[model samples]
Target: MSYKAIYTYAWDLQEAGVPAAVDEFRRLGLDTVTVAGSYHAGKFLRPRGTRGKVYFPEDGTVYFHADPARYGTIQPLANSLLAEGDVLGELTRSDMATNVWLVLLHNTRLGMAHPESVVRNAFGDPYFYNLCPSAPDARAYAVALASDVTERYPVSGISLEAPGWTPYAHGFHHEFALLKSNAWLENLLGLCFCEHCLASAERAGIDARRLKAQIASDIEAYLESGIDYPADMAEAFWRADLAGDFELQSFLDFRCGVVTSLVGEIRDAVRADATVSVIPSVARPTAGAWYEGSDLPALAQTAGIIEACFYEASAERVSADLFDLQRRLRGAGKLRGILRPSYPDLASKTEFLGAVQALRNGGVEEVAFYNWGFLPQDNLAWIGDAMRELG
Candidate 1:
């Protein structure tokens, strides 16, 4: 595998274009990059949870957004994706050390055109937001979007931001819900009782109704006790609220299968050696609720890389932990760390460099920084210098 340091995404530069940023990255020591998002790329995360918004993805694994739209479709946003690819390709052509990773935003115009594909919530209410991967239109949209990526620019490959799982099973109005919900900043995600989800469970050999009954009983018990139970119990009660592990795992497996399967299909669409990868949540659900439900065994068969996503500015321990999580995957050593440079978490030059050192020390082969535009130029310059100096 290549031991390259990459920036996760090109942060939106409303004023400065992608070409400028890519040029700067080449000068900065960035040999590889995985563009995080461009223009309302996060549109698909609706019915949002406490984390504000998931960008897009109100639905579960199979569902897609009702509509697909890109952010800032004006001159800058319009040409942003291609511009970045062009610049990234320039770096690659100039020197094999540089590369690009393209991704389809879940909430783009492509997602809007296919709402039925988005996941339906517990109330049979689908978030008018998010893209549903299970819908036929989703495949069509992806094929077209991905084709544009592989065909148009100098993209080395593309990867999607990791999909999150909501373990809390209360109501779509539940506290953890992220997008398309009444609350955008709570820790409450409800149990999904939508017919499609139930049917999916049933198809997985589970009796969905039984699971609902369990959830009801657990909730009643928890309510009668009048205590804040552990997240694990809350989750077990919630999932049992829907069905049994057989069905839950079955649902999880099916959902995870959808993503990995897409990876396979995407592999067919891009360059034969174009790498296909997924960024999954670092940990597993203790209560087996919901989160990035990746099938590592299955993923190992197709994915060329694995990424651990988290906001930048995390503790060094977090950087080490990210490295550890990647290590546990089937490829063991072929793991990369993804860091987002969002607000309230702007990593400093020292902090970013420390993060890189920690991950390298932890045995991570590749480290990616988030959004290029938002980060201070000096930071990238520092990173470039560090990458050249680091072993």
Candidate 2:
């Protein structure tokens, strides 16, 4: 379909209220809105007097009863703006396809509260903000969240973000220093050895403890000597020597399997009415996509759409990124380009149009803006103008 959508948070609906916001979108000639169904903490809509971390507010989920029993407390935000019956239904009546955007794993509250469910590094230090995909409780939590959203809303699509395990240096405060101190070593350091993950490897007949110790020793040696570390982490993976390390290779495959299982579970849980999609995190030109455990071909079997992000400062670079994403997807699924409508690339009307054109040329069937609450009215209006130009 001719889908032109924008990404919005629940707070955006709260700020302008549903009626006014819907009118603004229609006035801008947009056909769909990918609203954040579940989210993490952010400063979105702060200018409109909205504040603090919010969870499960707009989502009408009672949550799995086992959630609170298994983990001390399960609390989601209440008094949500979309709690009203008419808000989302109104979008549907207005012929606006509502796409529910769920942030799957990067939840600060869940990650901080349940350390056992989060990622553990080679040193066994838990990264409290990124969930481990191998954790049954964590995967169940995600599936429950997805099922709740799909069951509650008459959504046209469901977009899953951060569904895989996060990489090292994600929540760590020493990212810059770590980058300077053998960044490739940081890749080796980030491998998870959590109990759940270890058990998974052991089930596959791989010696988990021995592999972890070897990885730790290698990382430490690289950090101390700054020698023998591959200049690029991506190259290290493809090198024949790493392939010889069966345990290391198995661990990599295991990570991908965990992510695939979770994504597949969510896809199966959600009703067939809503299209399921995933946004895999990849820092361009890097094999970080695979490192993030998103096997595109595998995920495509369940996820019908792949929402590729095109957040570059230059329109030309935006085109390049979209092209790169298209190549990676390899017809695995439909592509939807997500753009940032702010300075540099979208500073002028021509630039904004150029970005849209680039996405279109890259074979993106649809396009969506990054956020409604984060930018100014001028930027929002730019989207309207750009749509008119495309027409």
Candidate 3:
């Protein structure tokens, strides 16, 4: 049977009532409800929210009550709502199969508290929103978080998001910059030169100091020369540039190894009964996942499933993305494609159904919608219709 699910926030279900939300999910022909176990702050406009139309969650807080004893230098803060009730526990007790969606290593709140544990660029400026996976404390915290959730709740599985490095251009609140942005510049600035990363590179026989200096110098030259890299040439730029630089390619490969090992550790830490899947990268097309340290084949071997977010506008683009990802995975693991059924990705129900059809035709046995709160009631209907028609 094809597995169908919708990504949902814990707060949304809490307001809508757990039992009622489960009924809605079942009504939509979904087998599972992947709710947020831990999440970052976001100003979300909820179309089906009962509490309020606009909502902002507590920054970098877990929806479930976390075991304090399982943590170290970095820890997860429980959302204030947990004081009133256990939303996650309530959901697990319901009829729907529950999967905890964890946003790991992307908490700005923890990064701000433990500055030394966050990702630092070549210039030593910290990206406070992203915790460096190479840091021992950060790595321990991620594993502990996953283990804690699975241990506490009778969850079927856990989907790990942002378990590796994040890009520099990720939209943070009120983010403003005077300089022009491109894939080349963002990738250059996103290179982590933190002490942990440098030490890892050294152990791998790389000239860490020289590479750091070279990247810093390259950024300076690019800025001074006012080079305009066309957005369309992102893939071509990386191919040509990395092909010429053996050391740079090795450095990126080592970064992927860091992420892969961290994910493997998390997978081992979780209970054997609970499935451990990973959102390999937030990058579109997923082919540019190397910049965020995600190796698809390596991840497929480490985790149970690779939930590739194929967020494209057309069904053709969605099919093309699945084909590329399948070729890269080389049949190492299961693949689940995630789609955004609302505007900017799909304009009408027809387009949404077409995208779902494309994934099914591409040999995907499982598919998921982006989020419950973000979509209109019409979009929910689209999901139900698509599930019935496809099945």
Q: Which candidate leads in lDDT?
A: 3
- Candidate 2, residues 1-391, lDDT tens digits: the string is 4568888765556556767877788898898888866666532343333554332242222211112322223343332343444455555555678888877777666777778888888888888767778888788878877777677667787889888877665653324564353445556766789999899989988899999888878676756874554457545644653568887777788888889889999988888777888887644532356788887667766687777677677688887777666667677878777888886346666677788888777767588887777667778888888788778
Q: Where does candidate 1 stray beyond 4 Å?
A: 1-20, 36-105, 108-112, 162-200, 209-246, 282-290, 310-315, 330-333, 340-350
Count clashing residue pairs in model 2: 0
Candidate 2 vs candidate 3, lDDT winner: 3
Runs of candidate 2 exceeding 4 Å displacement: 44-94, 172-182, 223-246, 285-287, 344-348
**Candidate 1 — worst ten consecutive residues by lDDT sum?**
58-67
User: What lDDT does candidate 1 reach at residue 344?
Assistant: 41
lDDT of 1 at 233: 64
TM-score of 1: 0.66
Model 2: colliding residue pairs: none
Candidate 3: where is the Cα deviation over 4 Å? Answer: 230-238
- Across 136-222, the per-residue lDDT of candidate 3 in tens digits comes to 999999999999999989999999999889888883678887866787778878889999999989899988778889989988887
Candidate 1 C-alpha error for residue 319, in Å: 4.6
Tell me each candidate's RMSD, in Å, in order: 8.1, 4.5, 1.5
Model 1 clash tally, residue pairs: 69
Quote model 2's TM-score.
0.83
lDDT of 1 by residue, 1-391 (tens): 3635455333232124555555665676676655532223334232212334334322222111112342122111233334334444444444434344433323434334444555554334454334445544554555445544555455566565433233233213323522232211112223444555566667767676676565555445544664655656655664463464565455556667666666666667766655656655434221121244456555556666666664544556556455445545635425666654334443565665666676677676576765554445555566676677674
Clashes of 3: 0
